[model samples]
Target: MNPLSIERLKVFPPVSNLDPSIYGPQDSALKEEQIICHLNGMSVQQAIEENKLFILDYHDVYLPFLDRINAHPTKKAYATRTIFVLTDMGSLKPIAIELSLPEKNRNGPPKCVVTPPVDATTCWLWQLGKAHVCSNDAGAHQLIHHWLRTHACLEPFIIAAHRQLSVMHPIYKLLHCHMRYTMDVNAQGRQLLLNAGGIIESHFFTAACSMEVSASVYQNWWRFDMESLPADLIRRGMAVSDATEPHGLKLLIEDYPYATDGLLIWSAIEQLVQAYVHYYYPEANIIESDSELNAWYHESINIGHADIRHASWWLKLSTPNNLISILTTIIWLASAHHAAVNFGMYPYGWYFPVRPPFMRRLVPNERDPDYTTFLADPEGYFLASLPCLDQMLHYISVLDILSTHSADEEYLGDRKDLSAWAGDPEIVEALYKFSMEMKKIGKEIEKRNGDPNLRNRCGAGISPYELLLPSSGPGVTCRGVPNSVSI
Candidate 1:
């Protein structure tokens, strides 16, 4: 039930200022005292003040959809809120988990509340609760994080790029490599993975609630500005903006493999983008006068993602700096971000028990017939609650395919056709420098993976976090950041 790293941790009680009543359950099942003991003597407020307390909050997001999700006989889910502390070792230690079900009506509290178990039976029950929480996380990671953030959200940009930006356009040349196979992959996703009664709906815990939940997240949480690495970290409350810090942000947890390695890649990409954009649009007025660039930007915002066209966070493409930041964000999303979430799927989830996509049985209670059965052989009952054999195989097969890399896969900086862009010597040099930076970043990731202190990546049984390692040959090597979301 522990998160892979502190990157998954969000600041306690998110920055959202919504009324408490809007939340699923107003009361926290894990009390202050319960977490205080685990905080190494720091008070809850102290931890919050220090940015040490974090939460994997699935409560409000999943709560409203739980009723429809649980309607299926074999599929069940819970609205879970897990809180954790950033230990001195820089690992995240899960202190409490609050599993809740919706109230019959709006007037009452949740139908059920489960916390850490006090005794053996409740410990077994607690395991069941953790399983349910895992089920919720797995569904969210796929639908919201992988598909929505990296795949669906970027489709409009891809379309606008192709439709508005001419093939010979500098911006088109800059973005074309990152857009490879994206449309093909997304078309396949809609037809197979996300289709009605398809793999996602049939196998994931949310089941029928999958797309509805994904749409809800896109409506409520996604932002274009937050797509960048530093901005995203600050928004999650995992880091504080500090002028004196590296990357201009102080990480709350210094040993985060994804963030630590990704910041290096993000900076590299930003440098390459700034250089390229400056070369093409030397003056701010050049961006303003560019007809194709303006059309592409307008189409991406106004037509492609029309649902959130009026979003407050949309960046204006007026200045060279603005264009640099925007292009950097787009490239980062296509390469590092997608790779982090996608390529590691099979390595981390091939074992169904590690990250079960769905649970068959609900939490057994005294009111249910299975409660007695649960007490007699808790292990057996727990195993029964997991996805059936066929479903597990289906889940593994899908992940194995999604996580695998093709032989012709183009990594972040593997461009071999620099001769095509030789008309511009500055752009050619910039691309060459970017490729070299990627190689350095790849080596740094290898060195960090060997560091025993970063427990999330290195340890006796821990699989090194190689999802952002920048390159790979082929197959599910569990390392490699493809330029686009090919799978």
Candidate 2:
């Protein structure tokens, strides 16, 4: 730690008397005991009673010829009585009186008491002392001391500034409102979809009835009444029991209203994708491309459909470029569908647009108005959105596969300099085992979907699009059921 300076003064007295001329005139004035007592604001009796006086001595040497010729010979050494006293406030004040004596050898010069400066505000000083005690090293002690002193002085002002900014910031209220709404919807959705006795039956019903009535009846029966079926058929049906149902056009349109629901989902997905790309690969051209896409979409109202179609194109692309884009799209769409089911369908401009009627209604004191609206058969919408959730999970699985493959490829590339046999055998074996296991799993998944072309990327590698196929299960069938009612 850096040295600290404090208010202090030092006094040096001369050795034994030699007419006071050789020693200097200033030394003459320091010889009187009364002066020392007067300087410390104490009488001789008070100083003696307090026992604050000390006699210090040190040997000294002068020129031999000058000392021998002197009438009053200078002694080789001398002693002085040093007096120390403190003010009522604990400030150190001292005085010294030279008691000239002829001495041959004595102790060294008297030690001076270095006083530390008193702090006006003792709280910060106390904090600094605490910091010093807690610090493990000299550097840490100095840093803590500096930080405490610096920040403690500004703490009040900083808190006041933060409070002012919170109120003045335009996005603060909007973000808080949106966050509250999202959390509420999430709680309601989890209760409806994930609870044991909530929507499980409805979910299963929708999954089971998603396919053609005839095929579904047969497939559903083999699993639902497993004991009545033949052993071979029952075994086969058991293998497909975990299948997921596909999201049909009717269901998509019903759950995702084009203007309000679809647009919000689309915008959210775009924002999320841009945020991901900008954070991870800021120097990449993808940011510029996304910005261009956004500009094209906002240029005119007529191009809105084109913008959606353009963004959707990445969903079909079997390249790494579409990884985050497609995943975010599916996630936002699924979340929007979930929200719409739990919260009634509301207009697009409700809470989002600046100066909207809904914005005025979004106060901490009031309940969300859209949540109170009456809707016919809200449970059916929740059931319909369940398939969208499945689709979202499928996309997430594809993202996992892509991420794993990319990491594996990068790892292998990094070790390209090493011979295959020279590399860590365990790591190589682990990679090979993982690939083989994934292939086996993929084959089973294909069997459940009854699709030979699933995950087959033009004989190159597995395609992420294969996740779009319904997963294998009793609830899934080889064919889709026609919509009984118009969407």
lDDT (Cα) of model 2: 0.26
**lDDT per residue as tens, model 1, 270-301:** 99998998888999999999999999999999
Residues 360-448, candidate 2: write the lDDT tens digits: 11101013243223133333322321234443344334323311211112110122322332334543443354334334434543453
Give the residue spans of candidate 2 off by over 4 A: 1-257, 282-320, 345-487
- Model 1: lDDT of residue 428: 91
Q: What TM-score would you give candidate 2 relative to the actual structure?
A: 0.17
| Best-fitting candidate, scored by lDDT | 1
> Per the 3 Å backbone cut-off, how many clashing residue pairs does candidate 2 have?
8
Cα-based lDDT for every prediction: 0.82, 0.26
Runs in model 1 deviating more than 4 A are 1-25, 105-118
lDDT at residue 223 of model 1 (Cα atoms)? 91
Provide TM-scores for the models: 0.94, 0.17
Candidate 1 displacement at residue 303 in angstroms: 0.5
